[model samples]
Target: MKRRHFAEGAVVAALAQAVAVPAHAQTRPGGAGWVTSWAASVHGPYPVGNPSAQPEQRFLFPSPPDGARDQTLRLVLRPSVWGRRARLRFSNAFGTAPLVLDGVHAGLQLGSATLVAGTNRPVSFAGTGSVTIPPGGQAWSDPVELPFAAEPASPLLAGRKLAVSFHVAGTSGPMTWHAKALQTSYGTAPGAGARGAEEGEDAFPFSTASWFFLDALDMEAPAGTPVVLCLGDSITDGTASTMNGDDRWPDVLARRLNAAVPNRVAVVNAGIGGNQVVGPAEYGPGKPFPGGPSALARLERDVISLSGVTTVVWLEGTNDFSRNGNASLEAVRDGMVEGVKRIRAGVPGVRVVGATVTSALGSSSAAHGHQGQDENRKALNTFIRDGGLFDAVVDFDRATLDPGSGGLRPEMIPESTTGGPGDKLHPNRAGYLAMGSSIDPAAVLPVRR
Candidate 1:
């Protein structure tokens, strides 16, 4: 839906042209066209606590420490649905310090679905496996630059995973994974692992947003193929998804699309934990406990211009409702409006699918969640669901809340999913799954030929 017109001709024309638009601008005004978000894929941060990262939790874990010495994680995944070649993304978007790793290998599955898949091929970063990720920054593997591909493999990753066994010279910290990292890893002190490390470890972290920056794991469609990006806060990051499980709804959804659909879509998870949509206040841009920087500050850089990004699945603002933001409903809503406007300006006609702020009411967390927070969420949801502002809406608020309790469902949210109710603010893997499932395929683009 278009915004209500208030400006006149030239000004409106300039505004229209200014958004970070795809190169295929019609070269004429008021003509006919919709910028298709081609080669767009969806994904999210998988959360996990690494025993090596947290020694206290080490014994509770079953695997050996990875990356502690310079480990390698190998993922063996074969795309069931193929298309033009695609680029791969590795993230360190949230690290507080520098990141380093060696040897990233990507290849077709060999004898088995295991990393031991015999006779597999090697994938390179830009061209080499070794790379560095600056604090709070991200990088992408050089495009595989292969030919258009397809699959008879009915299943997207039918028994496929990654084999990332590298040598760690240095790091910001221990690797914590959410959604159980999709690859097998080992750590050998820098310069270690001359050949490769063991594929299996005792356990792996299923971290949501902190996918340890990333190793060579993505299969990018050619520049013009279809892909979508999901960008936002903890919710979008798969915070509560299973460790090394890759079950975040978006992950789930990606597998679904790649497996059964003809669009050959991919999903990229750009969710940052504790991200906010209104100010630079979150990521400590200015003060302590500052939440992640506001969405506005980084939207143009992270979302609008991402490679192969066509459609953006945007969800955020729950942090705004918290006391930390101290933002009024009116002010926050206006902030969202502005964020959306800025986005349209950058990627002209790029579809923005907005997910309403879910309920934080009745959170068991003694910290906050008063009636006020709940009310604000409801108000924000109303504005978002009201079509004209966003091209589409995904009302997850209507999904996780218990119809009876009006909070997270007590049943669907057992101790495991709800984190045993300690601080009801964040859910466990199960809860994250519930939230992820709330995404409706209809809200995103339908299967387009």
Candidate 2:
């Protein structure tokens, strides 16, 4: 919204001069060009797991006949960049017991739960086809060659989707998952064992909006390739966007970058719906929040430790101002400062960009739209913009706000997920397109050494 008082003059003036840079101009640290092409921030388990912005009925998975044993998960993921080889990472971070996985496969996705004919290839861990991850832990599979991308930056790889299929070996007590996938991932009936290698959707009939176990996907790319990590809440997580639409702001940014810089940069999203920049001090398998952990809590796992993370675009903090959060603007700013410090410490020379929080003054949600919440949000945005806390800033507030209403733009109100009137909190696909396009690619590019 055009609040002359709220929009810090410095931020407005700075955003006017932001520009886009050539991908080749940015330098990549670490000789290994292993950038994360895809990622889903692990929240908790499914079926009454973490609270999510998505409709509850969408995650209504059929009861496991044998309690999560011998089942297969056919996950569909769209990588932001192309590569000839890829590695898979699975999480048991919330499981009460160990998670055993076997019969892992990755191939070009043809459609729902189906892979392109004869394209499925086996995946392994430490040279073995199976891997066991202990409770509260994670595992990364060995790299498997992608048969299609024989040449780097192939035109065939554009807008390509991958179907990663894997089977759970035994009982998994509370699966670890990214609760709001917003994409349809398939699963097999309980006791339906090891169907990952089959490449057929017949064995899988159940549908879930959450991604189980599988989280990060890293691709081998050319040296100096930049991986732009988008870290934030539902806006960054693609809420209100169509199911499997791949139209989240980060996704839009990724598509633009892929078209503009081709093989030079990868955009990975680590946004959790309902996420906050701070507060909710307690979190884990037992104590869960739909938003997962606070931004400060997840900075290490979601941003710092990620592979090839040369730059981070943080777009969060709306939740921190929610009544439930009741976080002070100073607290939120401190959290952002700490998060930036941690990211810099963990990944030296990484670029951290801050995004202005969009207006939620007229949100339907009760937790928001209270007196002073807007002030806190604006103050935080001002700190983000003019406090010298970030390498650069993206004015998302200006991009999505309605000057008169102090809410989402009129055209961005309809929910893109179900094609209905929206709650006016989360922006629709069209709004995301605007926010994505608003981001100056140059602002997110790694700083010159």
Highest lDDT: which candidate? 2
After superposing candidate 1, which stretches have Cα over 4 Å from the reference?
Answer: 1-86, 90-101, 107-114, 125-139, 145-159, 170-186, 189-210, 215-218, 222-224, 255-263, 279-291, 415-440, 446-449
What's the CA RMSD for each of the models? 9.3, 5.1
Clashing pairs in 2: 51-290
Model 1: per-residue lDDT, tens digit, 302-399?
A: 67655445567888877777766667888788888888888778876566888877666676655346788888878788888884787788766666
Error of 1 at 131 (Å): 4.2
TM-score of each: 0.68, 0.90
lDDT of 1: 0.49
lDDT agreement with native, every candidate: 0.49, 0.79
| Each prediction's number of clashing residue pairs | 93, 1
lDDT per residue as tens, model 2, 1-449: 22112123432333233223323222235444577889999877555333333443332334422236788888888888877788888988777788899999999888888888998999999999899999889999988998787765877777778989988887877777887788887888778889998777899888777788888998887665677899988888888888888899998777766665455578899988888988689888777776787888888778877787878899988889898798888888888888899888888777899999988887788988765888888888888899998999999898888878878899998988877788787899988988887876667766444
